[model samples]
Target: MADTLRHYGPAAVAWVLLAYRVSKGRRGAPDPARDTVWLVLLGLSLSLTLLTPAVYAFTGRVSGVPNLARLLGHGSMLVVAWSARTFLWHLNHPITEVQPRTRLHLGFLAATFAAMSVLFVLADTPVDDARFAARYAGDPWVLEYWLVYIAYLTPAFASMAVLGWAYAHMSTAPLLRVGLRLVAIGAFLAIGYNLHKALVFASERFGFSYPPAGHLLIDGVLPMLAHLLVLIGATLPAWGRLVNAPESLAWLSRYRTYQALRPLWRALYAASPHIALTPASPALVELVTVRDLNLRLYRRVIEIRDGRLALMPYLDLDTATAARARAAQAGLSGQALDAAAEAAALHAALHAKALGATAVFGPASHTPGGGDLDSDTVFLRDVARAFHRLERQSHHG
Candidate 1:
């Protein structure tokens, strides 16, 4: 299970991130940070894919070079690290400041890549080994190659962790902050993976045997987990624009508000059937039905307002005043106090109407205090909640 997860997990995450980025890019103007993120994601996808056992074996066999996939995987990881650093630099600094640093960073990366390639060529790895590090543990050139790879990665990952955390704190956007934090955590995890591999390589070089299970943790589990975090972090900021578009969230809010108003609406509808433009559906039918949600919600809100108007004659002012006092005493304030009082008055009015009581006061004039549909919906939802709570308390009493 661990092996399966390690082989597929990072690759899956990387591909998903890449696909999301591509989809998002088609809708917006080109952004440097987004483009940089795409490069980092692409590199991660390639590295993870190449490092998978099946792909690793195929690459080695096809190329007629032993463990060539290891070099390609390491090289792709180098690109991921470099691209990530570049993304951070572009995000936090002016273009003029970043340009000089970018050139220097690219130069260093090229030199590191060249050195690793030389070391890999010199290493006497004549046979393809999926467990390349463990198999070549004691080989001097292979050890140097591993050390050089670790040397490039350690500071890169450490700096990324520090920068990501710092930027996360500075960011005002909620999703961006969360994404940066995840990236920081992933970078920290990658550092741990690097240290673990370094320790394993050094232990083998010094004639000390490291635990075999440590290899699985270091190679598969740790990297998979780190890659997942980083991939999620990279894509999270776009989720609002992509997955949870404003229209979608608005629809969801309307659906919830519509549902929440059900108890209060049903009570009013039972008292005065004429208030509804259309007959009420059975509760189970209504629960399963979601066609034309906006229209349904609008109609429900209007019918609720009409029902409240119809019940106005039975709304005793004394009952409302008493309910408000009790609600205040019970630590309800603001909207809670208002909703509780409204619910109590409505409850009294419903009971009076049920008992065939004549209007004591000629239609007491009251309108729910909201200028617009959304605000009215919000106030009505609160009233509905309070009404439900009152019903529960009444039943218990």
Candidate 2:
């Protein structure tokens, strides 16, 4: 169980990251097909990682089917090699590049996989041997299997390492450079995995016992460590960006709200600057600090509401109803429609106040839109958008 966890835990993490990257949808990235190919590579790596334990437990049943797990594992690795080759080619070249060479590479890999599958089915082997690779080391078909499989994977990882290092050197973006460097490092480690396998094959062919250190580290440690590093490297860019995005976006959103509410706040403060509990600074400076911006926005909303209160008697309901109808006709609805109505009401009230019109009703006669400070700021942004139109219409009447 511990061995299974050690091997498959990062595979599960790789699967999760693959799902998230897929969900985010690619836009503006170079070579969208490369993205899909890399996804397939990781997905197959994860599937094969998961199958390790199952293959161990059911070696008899698996070997009975000419060792279906081993055959599928080889096929999976071949597909990964093909995918990596295509992705690396796409990464380095433009869309105008000829694809025949790419197709040939994939076709050759598929052919190899097909030949190996046929060989595995035909080869005689002990059905109950749990350690198939070591137990069948003397078999010619099995020896060819190891050689051909590694022949494909060794160069694939070596090319990936080379491409990753080259791209890392060329890239100016900090995060991209970091991601590429990690990929190169991980791929470099994976080369050792292939090398260890080659050494195992040499030991079997030449009839020399592998060193105890090689037996322990190569078979038990190298592949898991290599896979974990590769998974981490693959996920690093998305993980870093997603970690930083929300705070950055939130700060930008608050500042945009502060700016959007500016027109209405400025107009109301001009009419009734004395209504503010504290003397205010210039709008630009007030909006710079995120912590202070919330308070500043709240104050602006309150002062605008106060100024409206002082000019309530001058508000003509008939004119407001007509203005709302016009705004609705112009496609404003929901809170935006209400906001336009509020703007129209306030514009009429401000004009009447300027002409020294007296109050006709008490505060008890007024109706308020039931809203708190946050919703008020949002509503007021829409009101600000409609303010100029409301002013023009009121003057025309």
Candidate 3:
């Protein structure tokens, strides 16, 4: 089960991220070419996962090529290496100027892929045996095939280690630095994995016996752990914004509070347009700063309180008492009762004010105010909801 999870977990994550990118369209990447490379990496990882023992068994039977899974895995790894290297190159270099060495790197990758393909085709190995790497370790053809695979892989992993480490230190952004550091670490782990596999096969060919415990750690555990780290590192920049700036989430909440308060504000603003001190811009676009959002929301809360204070002069104690009784009968309690009673009072006051009712002098009760802005926002939102419900109920009556 652990092995299955190790094999499939990264694959599942890769495909999900790929689907998310595709659905989001251009939002996923600033550069289309670079985005395409990332997508290809995701696709290759997903494909390699599906080409595992269970699925490949069926595929092999249908294709009449017993050792087809090895070829598929090799091909997928090659593509992933190419894509990752290209991605890093683009990331490191300025977007305006294409790197001169890019074409040469592409040629090298293409040559590597071609050579691996040729060797796999030429090599004779068992068709149905899933343990192709271990079973054919001593075979001359298998050794050549392994060498071809590792030759490109070793260099690719090493380059990633160097590039990732250098860029991580050079980067100013906290999230980017951390992500690149992870990538560097993962790349080194991958290098270790490749080296271990090479040594295992070489030992078998050279009649040198090595400990099984060390082999298991190098071959079995390392690859899965390395791939998981690499995937996380590669995708970290995309998600780091959410992780780094918790204030962004707070801003979002404030914006939502502003929206929820809209109906109440509009009603109050209609009654007292002078209450608005500042010109309102698009809440989402203009309120980019946390301070701005907080200020805007604060002004809105003040304006609402002012409107409530103004309406209080026209509030009749008899009407409030009757409404409170009716609300109680309607199953309102605590905050809900307070909100309902206030809504009823406000609706009556607005109507009475429209008809110019004489000001009534009575003992005044204050709006609940003790908690921070978040609590205030929630309380006011409930009041607004109750206000709307009262208006709807009155209209239908």
Task: Report lDDT (CA) for all predictions.
Answer: 0.85, 0.68, 0.72
**Per-residue lDDT over 1-397 for candidate 1, one digit per residue giving the tens place of the 0 to 100 score:** 8668768777977888798778766546766676788888899999989888899999999999989999999999898888888888888898789889878878888988999999999999998988887688778787788789878888888888999999988987667777888988999999988888777778878878774665664676777789888888877877656666556646766888889999999999999999898899888888888899989998998999999989888999888889999999999998778888999999999989999999776644565546798788888999999999988898999
- What ranges in model 1 sit over 4 Å off? 26-29, 209-215, 240-397
**lDDT by residue (tens digit), candidate 2, 1-397:** 8677765665676677677777766668566444745654465664455356565447447445645666776677667656655665666687567277567777778778877876776667746354565777666577677667777777778887888788867866555566567666767776787676666666776778754564665666766676666666655656667677445545666778777766766667677777778776676676565677667667777777786776667778876788789889999888877888888888777777777888677334444354676676777777877886655565697
Structural similarity to truth (TM-score) of each candidate: 0.60, 0.55, 0.57
Poorest 10 consecutive residues by lDDT, candidate 1: 361-370
Better of 2 and 3 by lDDT: 3
lDDT of 1 at 46: 93
Tell me each candidate's RMSD, in Å, in order: 10.0, 18.7, 18.8
Highest lDDT, which number? 1
List model 3 lDDT by residue over 26-130, tens digit each.
654378344744755474575557466776687688788877776777777766776666667777677555455556766777887788778777777755676
* Candidate 2 segments exceeding 4 Å error: 28-30, 41-43, 55-66, 128-130, 212-214, 244-397
TM-score of predicted model 1?
0.60
Q: Using TM-score as the measure, what is the rank order of every candidate, best first? A: 1, 3, 2
